[model samples]
Target: MTTNEETIVMTPLWLAIEENLLALEGQNITEENKEKTVQKLVGELDGKGYAVSKSGIKMMALRWALEDMLKVGRPMLKDLTKALSELTLEDLANPCHASYRVTDNLGKTWERVQKTDRRDALIQMFEEAKLDLLVQKAKGLDGDLGIRLLIEETVESPVILERMGIPQEKLDQVHADIAAEIAARNKVLSLLETVEGKPDHEKVKFLFSNDIPEDLIIEVAQIAQADIDKAKKAMEEELKEQQRLAEEAAAKKKAEAEGPALEDIPMDQMAEHIYAIREIQYFSDVEKEIRTMCEQSAIPKAIVDLSFSDPDKFDELEKQCEG
Candidate 1:
């Protein structure tokens, strides 16, 4: 064959030997054993119908190594070596070209070429490493709370959800469910704050006053109750001191102040004296005003009810109505 044809035919053999040499480096094969290893590799390549000589292999290895050392920086070489060190036999089975586009810290773009098999193996290893990191982060979280957080993160990022390979319909459902959960939790928290100093029965009544799901309300209430118990226990001594002062102040006021005999009045006539009754009256008046406004604006009662139940839904309905 001509010299040009000979060079073309010999290139692949040289590259194969170089790859094997790199693999040996990765394995940490001792220098004393490397010659035998390369000789054996030469035999295998020769058996495969390649024209390989020991001296030719040595020349190619030295040339390729020098070229790589000259072209690549230390950090990049270290990373490449580390990646090669972790390769498996299976990873080397399917050979293809894999192109990489990366940007360095100095904003310089670098295009690195890799074998497809190696790239796939690295991707798999990276995914597993990320999973391990996530598990470590989730170690102390309560059961499924960590998973819920992950789902939330996935739902928030459309790209992540798409990459997860979940069906579009399922993703939509998850998004809806997470949104409802967040809204319900926020509503529960708002109600809890509203009834912060109220009795448990009053708190339950106020929570039920909103159009929240019974199961969600119960769950949030239980969690809030636990937090309330912890806080109350911590403030127990302070509360006792405040109670004693309140009682002393009340006794002083009772001795010095005079008031009408409202206690002698009939229960029905004493409605204004009851705070619960006053609250009911106030809400009833507000409801009547809302109804009047709805009727005057020709708005449906359903829309008004939605406004009370879910302001978000009501706003959407209002926009549709306007449209």
Candidate 2:
């Protein structure tokens, strides 16, 4: 029969057996129960016209269980081999069980009892699953930072990539590329720091002189200009505050030298001065003293006019006070 025709005929049988095996998952199969379970599977397969023996059913079940265990992660080979040895089927199976050999990723083979072809197929499946997981992890990572972390991990545990099938020459090239990129980025950062507070043109010139990339130079220049703007604003505010303080000091010194003007003196003190001026003997002396007091006291214009027009009003006020 042709390969395609055989595949079509065998497909349904494989599916039926797999369905029955799935039902046995999570069951506590012991020495007493294992033979009965295997016989039941054999009978089921026989009724389906495949006619597989009890031993064949047990081996298929063990292969299915091992495949399931090795699906997601790096399962230890020794653990798997130990579990294989402890199975109830191991005690019941024929002496050919001792011929089984399991080969690990490290090229170390453990001799046990299993068919060569089946054991090699399972080992291949495990390696493929591990490679698929590595690919998924790689797909999730991105950007320079992601690349840096990936490079670091590859350097620390190179076996990880080696198992992924990466060659040494390719790995060396990747390392060279990473080093060049890191060196360029560090140079840009150092140049940015050195050009701080410099004029925009000077910063741009300095970056160009260092042979920095145009895009990076633009970015760093903008940063430098922003810092300059911030410093200028701070200096302007400080200068304004200093000018205000200086003006206040000058005004205070002037006030101390000249004394308080009449407007600055209290109204009650102005009243006292006016009453004392009225007590001067001569009219001329009273007028002169009143004018002099008005000039020094800086009293209102209305009060000054009233004092000159009717000097006796203050005399009347003094008499009222004496009374």
TM-score per candidate:
0.30, 0.27
- How far is each candidate from the true structure, as Cα RMSD in Å? 22.1, 19.1
lDDT, residue 236, model 2: 72
Per-residue lDDT of 1-323 in model 1, one digit per residue for the tens?
Answer: 25655643333543454455454444533457646665676676666556566466555644444344334433233454355445343333322211132112111311332434335544443444444444444444675455455564332445434434445676567568778888889889887898898766556555656765556656887646554455445457667999999999997765333223433434443332232323443656587775664454444344345457786864554444445
Prediction 1 TM-score vs. true: 0.30
In candidate 2, stretches whose alpha carbon ends up further than 4 angstroms from where it belongs are 1-134, 137-149, 152-157, 199-201, 215-323
Which candidate ranks first by TM-score, i.e. highest? 1
Instruction: Give Cα-based local distance difference scores for all models.
Output: 0.50, 0.53
> Per-residue lDDT for 232 in model 1?
46
Off by over 4 Å in 1: 1-128, 132-149, 153-164, 223-323
Q: What's model 2's lDDT at 321?
A: 48
lDDT of 1 at 323: 50
Give candidate 1's error at residue 113 in angstroms: 21
